[model samples]
Target: MAAQFRRMAMWTWPGAVYNEHPQRMVERLQEGHVDIVIPYICGQRDGHTCWTAEEYDERLRAIIEEAHRADMKVHACFDEVNAYRAMPVYDLRQVRKDGSIGSVLCHANPAVVDYVLDKLRWTLAEFDCDGINLEDGYIFNQNTIYDPAHTTGELFQVVPVCYCSYCQEHAPIEKPEWAQWKQEQLTALIAAESALVRKQKPGAPFSVAARMPYDRSFYAPHKQEVPYFDGWEVCQSRDALMADWAAWLRRGHIDFACPMSYFHSRRLVELETQECRHLSPTAANDIWIGLGLGECTAEYRQGNGDDPATENAKDPALRNDGAAIEALLLDQLRVGQEKVVFFSYEHLLDEHLSVMARYR
Candidate 1:
């Protein structure tokens, strides 16, 4: 018989993998009734890979074998352009409007796209994982600078980016040209990656960890005092970020559009799911509602007015909020969301696991 829900667990933090063996982790995931595990494999943060490529390979294989034994699948997750290994070329990295070099690599750069696609090909070929998930890379960043005034870097990824030589040279000189170019570049990248994934894996799922669907009235800048809250939405604007994920869905590049709706409120979560269902072409299991079980404003689950008080925390930790977590897990199930990928396994404590196990 089919399970209650196809629970997919995400594991992004390298610290979790670094501390515990892959076998032990998969065992815990099985306990949570997880059918799939999406792990951060070739991700880079703070200017370094958490482990060597050899170590990643060994760890990934260990995870795959262990997960398969437990009847669970492992989808090795790849960070698109943001988590690149290295970009020595100045033109490869994005340039901020302030004339400073941006942290994220240029999406439009052929060398950058080539490197990412080659890396994706290599990882899928090397790792005996069941599937794949892609995330990040889309942020044009400082859209709120124009849309919603009182700006601070805390909300967005600092400022608008990717005025690099590549974009400047290739893009036509016109108003809104840069944003349009950015969207095309990312779409093209997804298409290429999707083609490659389908060719190589044949049956493996190509999932994308996209931002929640845009609803201007419900979102900040339109409603809330602050505009760019990471907990509520991905960016100030999807167009500004060039995250045309709805179109990607229409194009059918992604098998699953996992919206990262990491909001604390149940009402907000429902709103995001509704928006996703209304906007996206895919339905059922294809719209994987990503509940923020990891590190976000994850405590309260209430209707409490339109915009309730929210706390957005960056320090990744599993708080003692079993009641809230359970509510999210079961509520999504109640609403008939066939698949829900919890933001992470790393932040899930023993209590959280207990709640997860009992949900099934």
Candidate 2:
């Protein structure tokens, strides 16, 4: 049953195996029955890149070969715009409306887009892997900047962004269509990368790890604005990040739309699973629902106060019960069309593996 679902695991570099014990970790993954392994090759977060220049290539090939030897497929996972591990190459900062900088790749800049295409091709060529997952982090906030001069090395901002001269020239901000243009930029970027991947490796699968909606309500952006906030301004899925993933699936840009539905409650998990299925019923098999194991819990499920009680933290449902975990897994499986992929392997325990192995 797990084989039917394409059981996969994600591996990040500069940690555990990538840094040390590469072969051992592969062996461990085999024990867990992980059929596909997605490795984080290049990324920049907090200030450190995942792989260093010297050992990046050699080490990645080694890990890939190890996974292959274990009869596991290696899917290249690229951290889109979130972490530029190969810094300075595509580290064009995103400038917010307040003139602050955010550490994300500016998709509006032609150079950055070109760099992404090149990088996608390079990763496919160098790695010689099975396929690719154009991983998310495509800017949840509107504070994106295209002007290179405003690169202040600042973090994410709460305000809107990119009223710069370059953005103005390419996409006039004063126009009501500016938001649509931004969404197009992201969609185009993915489309270009997908085309390259197909050209490089014919018929290879391409998947995307996307953010899932918490509920029917999309009012997080308007929480503080209260009385001044007009009801239902724009769908968060459409505008903020411009992740029209259903369209991507419908357009055949990605083989699978894996929503990271990391909810603690089995009810919410079922709701999200159904939502993904409803997003594109015709392409229902293409949707893979990502479940969070280990210490993953939703904030809403957590109590309202400081050090609030949480289900996974306190209850045995998500904590220690193999039956509980199995029940949740079965709930998602009940969707019939949707596949399941856990967030990580490190967080999973022995009981988790035992239950998962049954499905395998």
Candidate 3:
């Protein structure tokens, strides 16, 4: 039989901060029966900029040491989204249309790859972390590209469309264009980075948190375009997520899978459990589901509310409440997936603590 499933904390950078000292959070986590704490590290802060590599390293070291002392493993996130803030090139690749360049940076570019690798190296070398979590590492929004003709550094809030001269010049021969190619490149990068991390920290774990569903195109209007990876999906519905999840298990790219199931009703929870059962036969023994403890608001709970106007809004699927939290955990337990991770650390409140205690 497989080892008993363990609880993991999916913490955000700001959440980590609000948890105040790492030691205190670790104590609470232990009391809550958590086995791992995966803290988020955003690349930017307050919509302006992200910390330098050195600053990130210092923070990571503190968290890692504190958690380890409490017998809890620390899983550090190398968030690429926030990293974009510090990037000299705001776009991931350049797109060419109507004789103009776009803003997305080209992942094929050696410089971009090197820059990401350097950040990973810094994280590993500077901290005694137990694992590395790569979040939003693959999804590419359409507006990241910029026009090459304009060299001035003007901050534009709109999602950019890359139209750099280089993108235009190489448009015809570029094998992967914008979104599709970036996804493949990111997967390759993760495989390589995972190897690098393992080599340095032989016993450390490496995991990737991705959106669920095999086909997210159906929700395009909702901006839920699925990345082009063999494993992983982030979808709005559990049934939709399972359809793709079954495929991912057969492909075997994922070591473990965690679907963002933040629902409040027992009926939906039962549906999620049934979906997990269908996918389990194909899923690896280590595969587990994830839950969201943070991002819950009173308005969301009442069913007549406005969306939280914060960074959490970036992924509305994460918005959940205490009842939703209970339903998600109960479903996972009912489905026999002993291991579950919370969506974030920042939004966790006093009431949330009481709910987690029942599980312990």
Candidate 4:
């Protein structure tokens, strides 16, 4: 037998219910010794108008209750960056450098923060979830994003956000420093949310779906080889993304940080972990590497733009083979990683489950 991880978990969205019942999904995961189930419950899901926690209450409760019966901890995930609706939060989304609004919400604005936390507060009170997770938990825009709205000729006009009226009207400094101001906004948001979670459920783990830096040296292989990824100068690099999650970890605002460093290349994975260890010795242990079953290559959108949920995923052609998954899973274990979480539950194949069960 090989070494096992401290906890095995998955990130999933509301669409998972279509393929199998939440109850059965939890049971199968339990069979593979997966102890944590992190499902996205808040924010507007891509295709459906899953407006609030109340709308998802039944399925969310089903996932929680069944996971509990399997003795698994359920962590409800919230997307900090993406919220699309006619609501106030959507109205306050990050403004592109071109003056157009981006897809992600703006946490820098107090009103936006109030709306997000209000929903989170309700979720904590209602669900029997053991913890909370924030995906894209930052306020940032980058040139690397390939927005379907923008043609290649006009790509130079966007930075993806923070030029909204509040930022323009409330200039903290005549010329606020970019990185410092962004860092402050992100850290403050995490502190407030973490405090809220702990206050509601003392000792619950507060985790972030962390990001990795893009560099020619370490990340080249992932970019050059991966199917749909663009070779941006910097996509979701921590510093530019304004998500100083390591600072949050040092301040005890979060229980752990899981960087989404999904790659089939062992070299990229090693470099990714090396970067995490280099972030801060004090915070390194809390960094859980995020692996993925497959990278999403395409998504189906209707004329009105609602993404209907499906089991096979928005697309599944590029999913790693069973052998590749087995090797990647073992490679991380051998390299002294204490924790590893998969990118999705929807993409989990039978072969993937077997690999997890072997080590678990």
Instruction: Give lDDT for model 4.
Output: 0.67
TM-score of each candidate? 0.83, 0.80, 0.67, 0.82
**Model 3 agreement with the true structure over 164-258: per-residue lDDT tens digits:** 45444543343444444444444556566667776787767666554433343333443322111111132221221112333333444335555
The 10-residue segment of model 2 with minimum total lDDT is 145-154
Ranking by TM-score: 1, 4, 2, 3
In terms of TM-score, which candidate is stronger, 2 or 4? 4
Whole-model Cα lDDT per candidate? 0.65, 0.61, 0.50, 0.67
Candidate 2 C-alpha lDDT tens digits along 1-360: 322344555544335435556687677667767777777665343344555544666777888898898888888777657745545544466666667666667787787787778778777888868978766665434643210111122222236656544575787574798777877877888788889989999988898877655223443443452211221122135555567777788788988877776555576566667667667775346876776665454423332112223232334344324565577777766667435666665556667777766665
Candidate 4 residue pairs in backbone clash? 47-306, 47-307
Candidate 4 lDDT over 102-151, as tens digits, reads 77776688998888778778889988889888876464664344321111
The stretch of ten residues in a row with the least summed lDDT in candidate 4 is 297-306
| Ranking of models by lDDT | 4, 1, 2, 3
Winner on lDDT between 1 and 3 is: 1
| Model 4, TM vs. native | 0.82
Mark the regions of model 3 whose C-alpha exceeds 4 Å error after superposition: 1-5, 42-56, 81-83, 88-108, 143-183, 216-254, 265-285, 294-321
Candidate 4 contains a number of clashing pairs equal to 2
- What is the lDDT, from 0 to 100, of the residue 132 in candidate 1? 82
Clashes of each: 0, 1, 35, 2
- The most accurate candidate by lDDT is 4
